[model samples]
Target: MNLTAPARRARRAALLVPALLGAAVVAFLAQRPLGGHRAGWNGWVGTVNGIVFLAAAALPVAVLAVWALARRRRAAGAEPGWARRSALAEVGTLYGTAPWVWMILLPGVDPGGPRRRVNLVPLHDVAEIVAAGPPATAAAQIVGNMLVFAALGFLLPVRFAAFASVWRVLALGAACSVLVEAAQYALRLDRVSSVDDVLLNAGGAALAALAARRWWRRA
Candidate 1:
């Protein structure tokens, strides 16, 4: 029998978003090192830059996941709407910023790493040029971060013009960054809270919001 509207939407998220996100993850891993100066393996796209690119690319998947699941939740079935909760979890709260969490590699302390009161290094304070690279790398990382959230903002189901303002979303995003940094610092988990990350993240959000604005207008 044909299901209800909610069922179709839930199925859509489960089918479409996951398929897209899975493909992306596969492509990203296939393009390993995703950053820089890495030798190619099996002709896959290897480089640190890939990492930066993947970080941003994941944004669409996250958005789709949230919307799809949110839609699914609106259509409940057995199991207390497990489908909806699952979708909510996939996109809600910390999805956009998870990449940064992974980047920090705070699994534990490095005995040789420097001790810091907080990891909050101001975004501008971070040198655009590191021993391994130039501003492009730094810029990429920042862009990725913002795009992640901006895509999130777009998919967040908040379709109102005023509520969807870039300034508001960016502000909310920056506050989120601050809360994350504070948590890291307060826990003394050895994660440095750099103010620079906050700046880059906010900038990323703004840029994404701008992009979203354009796309929205077009749509």
Candidate 2:
């Protein structure tokens, strides 16, 4: 289905406008200093916020750089479509993933505290969050956990045939989540190592892969 020139321009604008607005928001947030001194839970929260902002601010530049590299590859006789898709997959995986990983690895308020928290029972932590009320925080926790691997799931299949299935994406997400949880435990980050997190992360990846199934099919 070919779009008329005006329709194509309109579609581009529709995508570009929101992206520009988002970049502006990220740039604004990145300029703000981390709140409070570097100590305690509040400090940790502030540091995470700062890191998130910085990552968001840098995302556009990273995307552009990847695009430029892909363009160069295309000029050097690489297939244009493959080059673009590969660049997007690479950048999306890194940009969407690294900040969350950093936040996860950052030591909690009591990094060297007496005990490292671990939740082996599946859904225990998730149940607690849901029952705790304050819908916003619960939603954020659930959604954020899901989004942690969503980009990887969505784009991995698009770039590689080996991961062109929802099950593979789910397994990949679970494996990565396990590694992160293990790091948190081994490093005594004071964060809970929860089976529920792995479940949610894998579920998110599977769902995202489902959404991208058409693209992956073409890939």
Candidate 3:
């Protein structure tokens, strides 16, 4: 079923306006310091919670900006569908990926107090997480690791023909994970840089690519 141009624009506006409104509300609320104890806005904003909150608040606006730019391109005679998909894929990938990466890179409070850790053995971290008590924590850890690259996997193929293959996404995810792990180790971030993390990240990317296969195949 094909939508007329006006119908499409109306549909887009319906979605976009609500999203922009929600983002504005979030941004407004985020200005207030958490727990209501004013530790100065900047101080609160430096914490992990603050960082995540700010990122979340900014994401919708960023996507909206990208979408408007895509519309401009379409007005200049670019293919409308291509412009829309490209904008969504590009902004979605970056916005979805960056926050996780930022969280991963944040230095541990006692980074200097402990030696940097590395787990070269495959599956070691996974095994430990599973065996560790508190199923919720374990699940969160596993899911978080997967999500770190999920957006990239799901969107890359949609935007670029070169990344359409699941194998290629898997390899790229693993390579990117390796660089992140290397960064953690080199920077003495007091985090365990593990092979299992690389495995999980890659696996997650591959799975996400599979989920998006129908769309990319059409592309």
Candidate 4:
């Protein structure tokens, strides 16, 4: 049966609600726990308190921005759906992904040690980390790397037509990962730049994009 525009929109929104929730759950599972034994490892990614405060502070600004955009669209006799969604997605994208970027940019402490490390061979570092590191540390590193760009992957297609395809999301994630890795190397942040990071990050982006495939903006 054919559905009217509003009905179709509502149905799509209904589907999106669950997909978004699943994305949140997946992201949550990929991170270090918020409290308990490992809580002190609260590096940038683990800094739940700071990230929550930032997100909370940004919410009102996003809401007001969306309201203003909707008012402009209504003044121009246009449907506010696109305007509202665009505004929300734009704000959400920045708000959700900024913490990851901040985390990546934070310098590791190594006052008396070598400044930088690099691993060019694909899968080499990944295998080593998995084998040599504690199980919990290895899991946290792998999952954290994957989730670095997962929010970008999940939200980009919903906001922009160009990112609707899985490959685009993959490429975007890889490129962004390269930038972050490069920065780490250049700044001598005592971090290892690894090919495995690019691989897992791109994989995460692809997986997240797939989750939002139904809601992707069409050309």
Candidate 5:
């Protein structure tokens, strides 16, 4: 029997991504660190908030795009059937989270109080939470967050298939959100660390995975 397509592609992509990311990272680090609070153009990975957003939004698409291009140009030797929808789902889930990540990260709401915890997590009242606004609304932050994971759900089962379990994938996305919250809290970045995000983010992924599974069955 011929070698498994996914296993072959994974092995190859694994080899390729490090080189691409490493080159970008090295190029990022080579620049000089300039003066001031949040200084200089050279500081790539300058802010954890932006970095988190970039990872969530851009890296998934970038890596997948590179993989697709390679698959298409396979030098008459190695090739694999590449699915566009699966990749799009994965990319959308990730990119959708970017706005929220940036919103939290950027120093916007000035906590005028002397106390460390000021409670600026948007929906303060139970009544407001029930009202439900647009995805970008502070009250509806969960919408974008969930949509992304839903995409993740579809992509993981349809594309990645065997690597990450549906539950595990949900957990992982939740974990990343937790990590971001922790990093922001610890670093004292321009954001608050909320346990609520972990819940919302995970919920999004679970829903996404459910949708994805259903789609696969239909396909």
Candidate 6:
């Protein structure tokens, strides 16, 4: 008897979660209080944001160039297969989300000093922002939160057959949001951790995933 692909995946799932968690832990230790605001960097460009932005900008150009060259070499042969497309999607996914992740991970600096703030109640802070009559900031924040994971929501289903559902996107987005919020709270980044942020982020990802539903891979 041979194990099916899904069975193989399920077997590996046992190790995948722990491995991912371990990597996340290591990344948390290496980046925060060390590579973040606590470090000796003096400007935004010198920070993770600038570094990731440059990398993201360069990734597609490099990947596509190689892809093009390979296609050219096989001009009289079959086109590149799932391996190439999947690789592009994987690399692009990382490149697309790097900036947002970098921004979220960047340590916040309190203009006055460091302080921990928390907003546990849902919709409370969002309502205040809306009620204050500065609709622009509120609107931007809501949309920005959604856009943080928009690329992942839009791209994941296009490549991976398993993530081709609205619910999966929502779950993935929520999980990612929780991690980011936890990191902010844990790192004492002088930022308020809010439940509303998670809602908006997850909602945005779900909506974007729906928009890309047409391109979702059929299982």
lDDT by residue (tens digit), candidate 5, 92-134: 5555455455545544245333333434354353234456654
Question: Which RMSD values do the candidates have, in order?
Answer: 8.9, 3.4, 2.8, 5.9, 10.1, 13.4
Can you tell me which runs of candidate 5 are displaced by over 4 Å?
A: 1-70, 73-80, 83-100, 111-128, 131-139, 214-219
Candidate that would win on lDDT? 3
Off by over 4 Å in 4: 1-53, 74-77, 111-114, 133-137
Candidate 5: residue 151 lDDT (0-100): 52
Per-residue lDDT of candidate 3, residues 1-219 (tens digit): 999989988998898889778766775566565654565574455566666667768866787678797898799898987887888888889888987888888877667555978899988888889898689999999999999999999999998989999999999999999999999898888888999999988999999998999878343
Global lDDT of each candidate: 0.57, 0.83, 0.84, 0.77, 0.55, 0.72
Per-residue accuracy of model 6 over 124-214 as CA lDDT, tens digit each: 9889888886878889877878888888888898788999999999999999999898888888877778898888888888998899898
- lDDT ranking of the models: 3, 2, 4, 6, 1, 5
Off by over 4 Å in 3: 17-46, 217-219
Error of 6 at 219 (Å): 1.9
Model 4 per-residue lDDT tens digits across residues 73-159? 778877667777766677667766777777776667762366678899999988988999899999998988888888889889998
Candidates 1 and 5 compared: the better one by lDDT is 1
Native-referenced Cα lDDT, model 1: 0.57
Off by over 4 Å in 1: 1-105, 111-114, 119-124, 128-136, 157-162, 214-219
> Which RMSD does model 2 reach against the true structure?
3.4
- Candidate number that wins on lDDT, 1 or 3: 3
Q: How far is candidate 5 from the true structure (C-alpha RMSD, Å)?
A: 10.1
Q: List the residue pairs that clash in candidate 5.
A: 93-148, 150-208, 153-209
